[model samples]
Target: MVTFEYAPAPESRAVVDIKSSYGLFIGGEFTDPADGASFKSINPANEEVLADIAQAGVTDVDRAVAAARKAFSQTWSKMSGRDRGKYLFRIARIIQERARELAVLESIDNGKPIRESRDVDIPLVAAHFFYYAGWADKLEYAGYGVDPRPHGVAGQIIPWNFPMLMLAWKIAPALATGNTVVLKPAETTPLTALLFAEICQQADLPPGVVNILTGAGETGRLLVEHPDVDKVAFTGSTEVGKAIARSVAGTSKKATLELGGKAANIVFDDAPLDQAVEGIVNGIFFNQGHVCCAGSRLLVQESVYDDVLARLKRRLATLRVGDPLDKNTDVGAINSAEQLTRIRELSEVGEAEGAERWSPECVLPERGFWFAPTVFTGVSQAHRIAREEIFGPVLSVLTFRTPAEAVEKANNTPYGLSAGVWTDKGSRILWMSQQLRAGVVWANTFNKFDPTSPFGGYKESGYGREGGRHGLGAYLVPSERSGR
Candidate 1:
């Protein structure tokens, strides 16, 4: 085979300027934490220090909750839906204007490729806001009954996978429905949330309407357990989601969670081989497979399993894993060292369990966290790799002899977040879609998300949807006059 070299096409780091240290955004101002504890956010691609972020404690959480409550009762609640929508529209437009800066900042902090940050994350963030903005005044017609009232203060905690996009998912609906927010971004990726605070200020949104707090799990616990917070929204691990559910138990507070998954991507014999290969690669390797809805499990029909695996391996070889700022880089670094360790440990377990592991010949960077795209064949239903959510660029392949066996294997997991089915037969697609228990089912494509589409999971994957008109219902309570 002949070799060809491609030139580097890097995105400019000058687009984003990081501060040496940052405080929490509380009541529309950057405030120092009461305990003075802070942590550094690093670029996972190079292990470069990005910023020192404040670690919110009980005191900080109290202040943020109070501010959110005050805003909800005093300003946001009194504001007309039309005016609230105007503010959200302004936020959406400002996000679009600063898209480059936000995308660059996201790539640096989250260790995702600039290509994904710029093309997928930032655009969807702005689009989410825009989509929800128009719903502010139309809540009466959203099938939630007429004159649905806001849920007071909403406490939102999001993961690091898609920082800005997740924030948009939690915040846009809350604000559009007139609920003030106290949002805590994941510890490793809080920079974009802070920048969003500046956007809220630029939009001239009322002070205390939206607050950004930064901290670890304790801070999240404090925020979630606060008595004043009327609603809670979380997107993270299944373990933490269950903990949040326990924390909110016996309280009047409503909660919505988008948790982890081990989604199965099923490919049948008559499926379009090339397209299924692309979907399988995109399913498991997109964003280095940090996605909550990633298709980490591959279920292929016995007749064409070899062909599908061959095509998938060839596709994985072409993926470039390097600098996240490189515009052409396909797979970026892992989000953090801790996550890399987990991936390594899990892959080792898979090997010990007699699964066949394979990775393309790709050189990982020495200075930062990196994991090459990996796939395990001969994965049985009993293997740990097949049942667990590795949440990395790892795929587990299992063969099935019939559609019944495929559906049985696909729905065998505790998770019901998302799944994909690839087949040319229309009846099989519909049958699989109906039989699979996941919340979202992709017939031919994988990892496609839209602001208008409702996204969530069932079973241990947590509850409640995060987008579309259904998402608005999470932040609203019907008026007594509705008489439901």
Candidate 2:
């Protein structure tokens, strides 16, 4: 096992002092941008300046690509699978050891409740590394045939929703399979990804194996279209996902996308009502409902529709909404002013399109971006909220009379990223799981995630899986069988 020591930086209540101007991570070392330009990353919770992150341009991306190419050819790809597993295992341990620090940084940067960052995101990030580490030397047992080879340099762009987890998902498997990577984190939340650069140094990962470029959409576009990048992996909106697909069309580079969703959290009459209610709230209200796989659409059985809605409203009223760093907080501020505007606009469309809107009787913070937990009932199949991805703390309730109707409404959209089913009967759950077209289906659970499970979408939600053995396919090239 690889060994490294971390001296915990003393905790400070002062928020902005922890991070400053961060440079690019190229060849496992932090360096200034080629053009010397930078962009400030702000805390959306209060608009405080978090850090001035490097604004990587085309030249920076080119240098990162060159470094990754060298690493893949000279060092990373040539490592034995057992040796590769050691590095992943080392990273996983380091993450777990520093879980507290990472969790604090995540809450400060992304405006998620500290409880969630500490409990959910950080643990899962570490879990992902552990799960993928075990697979490094066992490729022969995976469904993919023997002698799998690395795709020289992978180009990846991840959204702000789950910065560190997405980074782990992209880096762990790519490294485990002997491929080097060039990654760009979203402009809004670059802090955690930069912290990951420090972890790479602490773990003594080889130079040029993992590079992080911090910038806006333009930087991501350059990485995606660059001629030298061997593969592209993305997690973002469906509109941008389609654009990436079209841009890589007719090219030799491999591409995989994990995009947006409007998942259906179905509630059968026979389901545990209290449990289903909790799942419904969590499915939509978690992360301010910014999750791509968020169960934004609630399909309640017609018989208990009113009772379920009443219980759900009462539960929403009890949730604590406040500062993201507050240990007791349940909901947190919106990620950005821009995201707030999108949520407001889509909500307006829902009302204009004839859905009845309701919000809990809760006072929002006087400053920073905030929105109350909202629900819209009487929503028809044609409303924009029913059709478009709101990406906020909003829910649209539609009732179904039978299992067949639930399936029909659940699969109505262009997205098939994830779905949730709630029922007491094992056979009913199994049958519903098979009929649902999402890449991920949760029976009696909602918004559950693990590093070992493959996570991605089908249809317009986008293609390719990001976790499990399937993720390795995006980073590998198979040699044709000799017999064939």
TM-score of each: 0.99, 0.96
> What would the TM-score be for candidate 2 when compared with the true structure?
0.96
RMSD of each: 1.0, 5.9
Model 1 agreement with the true structure over 243-346: per-residue lDDT tens digits = 99999999999999889999999999999999999999889899999999999999999999989988888988899999999988999999999999999999
**C-alpha lDDT (0 to 100) for residue 263 of candidate 2:** 94
Error of 2 at 172 (Å): 0.7
User: By TM-score, who's the top model here?
Assistant: 1
Say which candidate scores most in lDDT: 1
Q: Where in model 1 is the C-alpha error above 4 Å?
A: 480-484
TM-score of 1: 0.99
Could you tell me the lDDT of residue 132 within candidate 1? 94
- Steric clash pairs (candidate 2): 27-208
